[model samples]
Every structure is written in C-alpha cells, then in structure tokens.
Target: MGVKNNIIAAIDIGTTKIVAIMGEIDSDGRLRIIGMEKTVSRGVKRGVIHSIEDTIGAIREVVDRLQAKSNKNISKVYVGIAGQHIRSIKNRQFKYIQNGVGEISKLDVEEILNENFRIPIEVGEQILHVIPQDFVVDKEAGIRNPVGMAGRRLDGNFNIIIGRTASARNIEKCVKEVGLEIEELVLEPLASSLAVLSEEEKEAGVVLVDIGGGTTDITVYFDGILRHTAVIPFGGDIVTRDIKEGCSVLIKQAEALKIQFGEAVADLVDEEKVVTIPSVGGWDPKEISFKTLAQIIQCRMEEIIESVKFQIELTGLHDKIGAGIVLTGGGALLRNLDVLTQRKTGIDVRIGYPDSTSKIILDEALNQPIYATGIGLILNGLNKPIENEKDLGNDKDTGSKMNLFKRFFGAMFDTED
Candidate 1:
C-alpha cells in the first residue's frame, strides 16, 4: 500500500535466531506489526558476528522472506547490537552558554551531549550512545529537560555506551553486503527495555534482564533514565550445553529437552517424571529423569542469576529497585525461572513480554518473550527518522541525515575511533 519508505523495519540478529520485522505507526502512534519472519542464526555467537559469509546468508534469508511477504522493497533497517564487549560509563560535561542570560535552547543541550563524543576512549573502542541522565543549570540540579530554562552555566550527566570497533564494523559489513543500511545501531538492552518497561516502573526503578541464546543483557533505570547497562557472556546456550554433556544427548535433543522439560528449580520437579530420548547412532534410547534435567538447568541458571545479582550490586541500586526485576527473551521461558530469580535476588521478579507496551500492536503469536528485542527494535526506530537511499553513503559526520539525527534525537554517530 503506502509508500515503502515510510515503513519502519528492524532486524534482530540474535545468537539462535535472526528476526526481520516491518511495521507502521498507526494514527494513534502505535507500531502495528505488518510482517515478521525468523530463520536459524548462523555465524553469530554471543551477539557478535564471526563469519561474514554465513551472517550475510542468514540476513538475506530473513530479509528476502520479509520483503516477499510484505511486498515492499526493504532498503534500510534499524539493527540491535549486544555482546560481552558492550559496556557503559558515566561522564559529566560542563559548558558556558554563549548568551549567559538567555534560556537554554536545544542547541545548547545538543552541544553538551556532543562533547561527550569527544571524550577519550580506549583505542579500538567506539562510542555508540551518549544519553543525558540529568541536567543542572545555574546551580539548580536534577532537570530532565532544560530547553526553556534560563541558565548561564549548564552541566549535564551522561551515560555513554562503548563497544569494540571491529565488532561494530563486522555488523555493518554484513548488513551492507546484503544491500541493507543500518539506520541506527541500538544497544540490545536499551531496545528490550523500551518494549517491556513501563514509564512508571522506570520512574520507580527497575532492572531489565534479557536472557537470549548467547548473552544475558542487563539495563537499570531509575527516575525514568538509564543508569547502567552490561552484557554478560553467558545465556541459555550454556544451559543447553550443560544438558548435552550431563544427559549424554545431542545438541538438538538438549535444546528440545530444555524447551519442553527444563526447569529452573530442581526442588519443584517430581522425582517420578522423566523424558525418553530416542536412540541415536544405533544406541539404545536414554531416559532422563525430570529432576536430573532440572538439576542440570538449575545449576547453570543459578550461576547466571548470580552474575545478574552481582551486576545489580555493582549499580548500588539494590534497595532502590521498586519494581524488582523484569526478565525477557527466549531464555526467560524456562519453567520456574521467575521463581528462581526472585528467590536468589530476594526481590520480586516477573517475566517480561513485548505486549507490555501499548505502543505495540501485537497478535498472540508475536507476543512471546523471545520477540522482545525484535519488537523493541521497531519501537526504537520510531524515534529515528528513516534514511534516504541517496544519503546512505555520505560521510556520517557531514551528512544531512546525521544532522537531522542530532537536531531531533540528540544522538551521536562516531565515524572514527
């Protein structure tokens, strides 16, 4: 129907699956899902691309299917990125307004945020985002928006995200090889939070835990702003690996067992319940007790939960989490996972789903926790203006599209490390 360029598209390149989605913002500003497709992931591990050819093939498969289903030519898309290499740091910037007596304008705010992009970063690392946490103007503190406030001196608190240059370049290469341009590279945790967290929960303080196939992404929010973000190197795949080794089954069987019979708490499983694995390689069939399977999953899951707890402690917001923890992603589907998390962290826990946001119009089939990041990517793209094909290759620093980004969203794009 309508012009294809107006459509918002996103591709979530996860460890176990690659999801491509296209949607349109309806009259009420809700993102209505139009077409979605997923295929088995290849050449990706823990959210990082290892094999260019394989990754390209996977991207092409999903993109082609999405294009065919939607009957639209997908030229550009917003993509999500997360891996162990992703980390965030806090930095403060100060600037003297040129017109000291005038109100703080959007230009002033943009300039202060842009200054963070110039801060010294480790070699081989690039700044991905510079989000303003709060602002202080003329000795007044804790202002979220200062565009119309009058102040001579402006101070800004920022959370800056950084990632390995090679990792980012690899993602860009794969998307480009498939003839798709990345509209923006969003951090996975940030995107998932948008899909699952409500404004009140973020205002009251909450921690978002996204357990995917390869990595567990964490994001903390308080006073409706992002406080910290981190990516742990472990996720559901590790548990599957444990099952494969502990149960003496194939990887596929391990995954099936985990999805069908895995439990996060061994104590909850009945001792009499068991699953039989069909014989492989001319060997006799194997019977795995449900309790034993739960034990294996619990051991590995406990370690991951401990890691998440440790990260929360690092934020020093343990007592401030009014909404406790919200778990999302494919790994969050494990039975009794919420129970295990709440028991371990001594806080309330709930599984997060993409349907939490009224801004997303999703059917029952697309409302699962596994689609959280992919759905969130489409939501994240709504804040960004779609790119014109002619402006795709222009120098990022000098392009008109980048200027639009800076003027509208106050986002940072670093072309050089």
Candidate 2:
C-alpha cells in the first residue's frame, strides 16, 4: 500500500442497499479491500435518498460493521451518487482576456471550466461533475490539459453531470448523522467504470452496463472519453417478479431460484434438465423444466440488453465499440448473461467483476460481480484527495479536495473504460 493510503472508504448508497467499503490504495494505485459491510438500504428509492432517518440507520450499521471488522478509523468517504435526478449535458465554456495575446494561466483554465457550473437548470438541480474533454485556445481545438499553455482566450468542452440539490442534501444529512462526512459524491456509473474497465478496452471503445436491483445503468466510451450514459427502469427485480408470477412462487423464493439456478439464455440449458420448485402451501414440491426457467430469464434480460443497445445506437457509437459490452451488478451474476448480452447486441460481452487486490477476509462475497459498484466507489475514492489529509495541504488550508482532476493529475487513467 502507498505510504499515504492508511485507510480509505467508499460508500455506495443504492436503492436496495447501502454498502461501505474500506480499502488501502497501494503505492501502485491498486485498491486492496480490507473492510466491507453492506446493509439493506432504507429511505432510498430509484437511487435517491428519500427518508433521511432510515437511510442514516442503514448507513450507520454498514459503517460500524466496517469499522469493527477492519479496525480502520473511518471518517471521510467517497460516496456514489445516482438516481433519476442525475443528468448529463455537454457544453463549452468561454473565458475572456484583456489582451489579445495574453498567456493563459491555470486560474484562467479554472475560470473557463467553472463556467460549466453556470449552466442553467431547475431550481433544485446542482452540477455533480464538470468533466473537461478538451480545450480550444484561440480557436485551436483538441488541446488536452490546457494548463501551462499560452492563449489569448480559453474555452473548455465538458460533460457536466448534475442532480437534484434536495437529494444531495438528504444524502449529506444521512452520512453526517452516521458520524461520517461525505468527502465526495461521484456518479455511480462513472465510479463503476473506473474499477472494472481496463485501458485497452476503453480506448478500443466499449459499453459498460451495470444492472442493479432497481435500474440498469449504461455508460459508453469512445475516443477515450465517456460518450453516453442512460438508465433503464427494468433490472433484476423485473426478472424476479416475472419468475414469481410465472411459477406462482413467492418473491423471496423467486430471488433464491435466480441466484441458485437462473440462466439468462435458454439455449445454454439442456432441455432434459428439470428442477423442483417448492409448494406454495403444505404440498409436495413441483418439478419444473429448467428450460422454462432459462427461457423466462432470457426474455427479460434480452429486452434489457436490447434496450441498452438501442441507447448505444442512439448515440451513433454502436459501431465503434471494439471492446463490446461489459456487464456488471447483481444482474450480471445470472448464468449465461454474458453470452446472452453478446448475442443480443451482436458484440463481445464479458462479466464486470471487482478486481479483488485486497487481503480482507470478506473478499469472497464482495469479490462477486454484484459488489462492483461498491468497490468501484472505493477505487474512485482513490482519485479524490482525502479531506483534512494529514499534513498534505499547506498552511493556507481548507478541508475540500483539490479539484475534480486532482486524482488524475499524475499517473492517471489515460483512457476511459
């Protein structure tokens, strides 16, 4: 682990659960998951924090679990933020200079980038990210890292992700109530992409589909930058419900079946295989063909992946995906999902599982593809400066992290994955 990486945490507050992950960032920048805890999330729906009290309780339990397990002092956290409120828009910001040939300074670049925060929005909206794609200096385009470059004028192209102010406030309240400060709030999808994707896949163009309980989030990258993001209302819950209705099984039983035996592609199943289902009342177990179960799952997962492809096509980057589609989240755990998605999208598909570089004991459970987002939240946290970093800041100090680009300032992930 890096000398400075004593203990860092990432909290994923999702619709179905609140997850807290503590890891040490080794000097090489790999996250070693040392402590982790997850609790059934309350006060959250559609990825938004709805009930502060319930959310606080859930957050506390998870954090407390992590603290006890790892004996790691936990305070600041890099949080994953999501929900229907999250929105992204591409915009260019311009800054004026007094002289026609004035040298562009770091302050000038900051001013131009900050202009993205000036984008108009509804009363309750706030900018979550100001991602600079490139800079145009005096009409020259495609300049990366404009700092230290001289220019008469400066402009920046950015993808600004914004979300509801009220949602953020409630999230902060819940985190603070649990005795932890929200150090940073990163978009959940962006965080996931960071942890699971590799440099080769990113530059080759790929799409990451994270299918969680309540929603299916899609993040697409081309030309080494995030090109598109979309969220589908359908997810694993949709399939579980379908099984419940189709087989007359309880929701819990349906979910159990999914975990134990579900397959996303029926063709991958043997028609002769049969699985017995529990009786609803006090009766004998019923035998059902495994083909039937696989078929049902394929129907729902196919639709979800197809919808994801539709969104990709909408962006006109469908053909550019050399890395194809990488699937993660709870839905990715379904058997044959990778095969099913590849068939549906006509592109290569692979499972997006967390890179377990940690030595913690709970790595078995958290190493699954389901925990990708939470672990990604931890990886993403590595990019942000720890608030009140022990003696890192100068005398003219404030607790805030340096900037959005601070994590990537050096030895950064050169390309998006």
Candidate 3:
C-alpha cells in the first residue's frame, strides 16, 4: 500500500451511475489506479442530486467498496458536477497598477480574477469556476502569461461557469452525510476534457462532447484555452425514452435495445432484418423491423447533434475547430455514432478515450470513454493544489457553508472522541 497522503480519490455521480476511484502517484509522477467501483445511480437525475438520502446511500456504497478493495480509509474526495442549470458567461475585468509602468505581479493577476466572483449573478445561482481565457497588459492582447511584464494596467477575459446554488449544496450535503470531506467540486465537462483531450488538439481548436446518461456536456477549447462549456438537459436517457415510447417496450428493454441494436443512421439498417423483443408481464415476444428501431434512434441522435452544433456556433470558432469533435461518456458507445455525427455536422469525429498520460496499465473496461471523467478527476486532483481552509472561505460559488459545518462538526466530533 502507498502512503496515505499519496492516495487521491474521486467520485463521479452521474444520472445513470456513480463511480468511485482511488489512485496513487508513482515515482515517475504518473498516476496508477489502485481501486475503483461503480453502481447504478438511484437518487440523481441529469447530473444533479434529487434525493439526498438516496444519493448518499449510492455514494456510501461505492466508497465502501473502493475502500474494501484497496484496504485504505477514504476520507477526502474530488467530485464532478453538471446539470441543465450549468451555464457559462463571458466577462472582463482589469486592475490599475498602483505605480505606473511596474512589472506585473501574482497579486495583480489574483485581483483581476477575484473581481469575477463579485460579479452579480441571478438569484439562486452561483459561480462554479472562473477560467482565465487571456490577459491584456495595457494595449497588448493575447498574452498567455503576463507575469514580470511591465504594464500600467492589467485586463483579463474569463469564462465563468455558474450553477444553481441549491444544486451544489445538495451534492455537498450528500458527500458530508457519508462522512467524507470534499477536496473540490470540478465541472464535469472540464474534468472530462482534462482526461481525454490532448494539448495539441486544444491548441489547434477542438470541441469535446460528453453524452452521459442524463445530460450532454459540451466543452470548447481553442488556442489552448477553454472557450465555453454547457450542459444540455437531454442525453442518452432521452433516447431510451424515445425507444420505449416508440417500440412500446419496458424502460430496461429500451435501454438494452439501444445499446445492443440501435444505430444512428436509419438508412444503414437493412429493412429485411427484424429483432424479436421479449414482452413484459409474461407476454409473448414481439417482432419489430430493425429499420424502425434505427429510425427512432436516428431521429433523437440528430437532434442531439444539432444541439451540439448550436453550442459550437455560439463560440464563433466552429470553423477553426481543426481537430474537430471528440465524443466521450457512456452514451458515446452507441454504434456508428461517430459516422452519424460527422454526416450531420460536416466535421470529423472520433470517440474519446482517456489518454494514457497517467501511465497506468488499466483494464480494458477502464480504458473506455465512460471512465474518462473518473480518470480525469484523479489527474486534476493530483495536478491542482489542494484548497486550504482560508481559500474555502473565499469560494462563495461552491458549497463554502458546508465547509464551515465540516470544520465545526469535525472539531465537535474530535472533542467527543
């Protein structure tokens, strides 16, 4: 077993499933997966926790399984968040140097970034992330790193992600109910991008589309900077609903049919072939044309592609997407989805599997697109510095109140013990 401090854990609570993973960094600075567990999610919908007790039970179950398998006590974890309420807005802020024509310092940059947190948001909403897109010193623009540069004024553009305040608090409540401390709450799209996108791809301009069970997450990167992020309310679950309604089958049967026989392009299906679907309530099996099933699936997929295209168009850099689109998440496994996406969007497409930058020899299952966010969470946790108690007080957009309770209750429990 590795040193306790060296171990990093992450929990990805999605609409369809909950995943808990534990990893440790090797001597070469590469991350290795020590243990992992996942189970169907019961209390979440579209990436948001709907029932706190149910969500807590799911998290506790997975965490216990992970701990038992790795023989390590899990105390802290990095978690991912997404939902229909998640949105991105662009804002700019600047700071005037106290002394004219002075070298830019870290404090100057921090001040500009901090200004974003003060920006007024809609009632009941809070900022989740403030990503600096580029810095401008005086008149010079497009400066990636402005430290040590002499400038009288520093200006910066940021992409701020915001979500409903209640949504975030619910997630914190669930984690804390399971007797765990949250290391940080990372946006699911950003975490997914970190796991699967290459620096070259980001530099050349690319769009990552993560189609999960309940929501579709979109992240656009250009010139090696995060440009935009969004979460559509619909995902693979909607497609399943369409199948169930269209074929008059059970929900589970619809999901199984979508995975086993669904195709994105109806024209590709041979009308001569048919599939027999077993009936519910001990009813006789029914025969359906394969083309009908493909048609139902194709209609829903095309709508999803159009939604993705609309998001890309909003960035105004759709034409500059040199690396095209990369799809990940559980929904990416739909057969021939890449081909359909390319046909609809007129751009190249590929299924995104998390790159092996971690250097961990993973099982074939972990290498799939569905695990990209989980793997990326570990990488993000290891690369990013841990937030101190003081920093938590300043991050109002997340669940800072919960952190306060954590500290107070933690101390109370310690005194009792």
**Model with the higher lDDT, candidate 2 or 3:** 3
Q: Compared to the true structure, candidate 1 yields what TM-score?
A: 0.92
lDDT of 2 by residue, 1-417 (tens): 212555678789887778888888666665677877888876887787778889988988998888898877787888887876677888988887654447776556656665666779889889887776778888899877666566777788877788889888888888888888776788888888877787667779999999888788899887667777778878788899999888778888888888898898887789998778867678678776788889889988888888998999988988899998989888888888888887778999888867632322235666677788887776766655443445323422221323455552332223321
TM-score comparison, 1 vs 2, better candidate: 1
lDDT string, candidate 1, 1-417, tens digits: 122345788899999999999888777767899989999998999989988898899999999999998898887788998999998899999988886557777667767877888999999999988877888998999987777777889999988999999998999999999998887788888889889988889989999999999999999998877888988899999999999999999999999999999999999999999888888899799899999999999999999999999999998999999999999999999999999999999989999999898888988999999999999988876655444434423455534334434422342232221
Model 3 TM-score relative to the real fold: 0.91
Measured by C-alpha RMSD in angstroms, how accurate is candidate 3? 6.9
Q: What is the TM-score of each candidate against the true structure?
A: 0.92, 0.88, 0.91
For model 2, which pairs clash? 1-26, 2-26, 2-27
Candidate 1, 365: how far from true, in Å?
0.7
TM-score of 2: 0.88
Ranking by TM-score: 1, 3, 2
lDDT of 1: 0.86
What is residue 197's positional error in candidate 3, in angstroms? 0.4
Q: Rank the candidates by lDDT, best first.
A: 1, 3, 2
